[model samples]
Target: MTATRAIVVMGVSGSGKTSVADGLAAALGTAFIEGDSLHPAGNVEKMSRGVPLTDEDRWPWLDTIGQALAGSLDAGKSVVVSCSALKKIYRDRLRQSAGGALTFVFLKGSRDLLTARMAARHGHFMPASLLDSQLATLEDPSGEAGVVTVGIDAAVETIVARALDGLKTVG
Candidate 1:
């Protein structure tokens, strides 16, 4: 139906959001936006120091992410956002700002998988130790009306296919 105007690749830290988002963008012939780039310097430092950011620390960043989503959708271009929208309220903000032209693909996996991924990750502000906190904060978006949940262990093709299928379903 070509109804998915934008795709938000969401999950906790080290959940493969960037890789998946980039791959999805390439598949859809759309741009990929790294949500990390929108984070303020202070936020980066806080996360890098193994400090989990509170909702107050996140609102501005989330607002910027929302703006990016809105911008891409407003231009009628499919863009994939790599973001850790771990909470329902955060997702709600993005949806509100992005209006109706947005959809979310929640990349989910086990704690062990996420922890291992985080441990192996290099040059990222988020630390492996923070994985626990992130997981604890994650509210599964499974039953959300406009959300898609893809397993992390699946092959990239399978994951993409699931996301595409989710788009069709939502459409």
Candidate 2:
């Protein structure tokens, strides 16, 4: 078996993090964790009400994701997780928790495209109203080590393929 790797599919809410991460996990034959599902109930409620989460509100959630990644890596298992790791600090936290063996696949897209995608979605806790907040908070990870930036303008399969190819360079 290939050595275990920890990967985070990160982007704004509408940037297809879930789909791409799911595909990536399947391709890698690893567990798929939806980071949003690990959020505290209060945080979900706040987002469901269209309220932007403060940094304080996000710390615990980020910690939870980090712990999940760390646990998988410690068990010698590859894992893919979906997270809107918009800020550099959040990504750094995840890296530290995962013992620095982490790579991120950043899904990039234009604002117009993201807004349209958010608008078309249904039954999601995050509202389109929070997209601006998320975009504002996003720190582009393009030049960061262990980071792969894949444009979200293509189909999910293409995006996943691009991410896999990019991972070859960083992983």
> Considering every candidate listed, which one attains the maximal lDDT?
2
All models, RMSD in angstroms: 1.5, 0.8
lDDT of 2 at 109: 99
For residues 63-138, what per-residue lDDT tens digits would candidate 1 score against the true structure?
A: 9988888887788777889899999999989889999667889999998888888888788878898888898899
Off by over 4 Å in 1: 1-4
* Residues 28-139 of candidate 2: C-alpha lDDT, one tens digit per residue: 8999999999999999999999999999999999999999999999999999999999999999999999999999999999999999999999999999999999999999
Clashing pairs in 2: none
Report how far residue 10 has shifted in candidate 1, in Å.
0.5
47 in model 1: Cα distance from truth in Å? 0.4
Among the numbered candidates, top TM-score falls to 2
Runs off by more than 4 Å, candidate 2: none
- Which TM-score value belongs to model 1? 0.94
TM-score of each: 0.94, 0.98
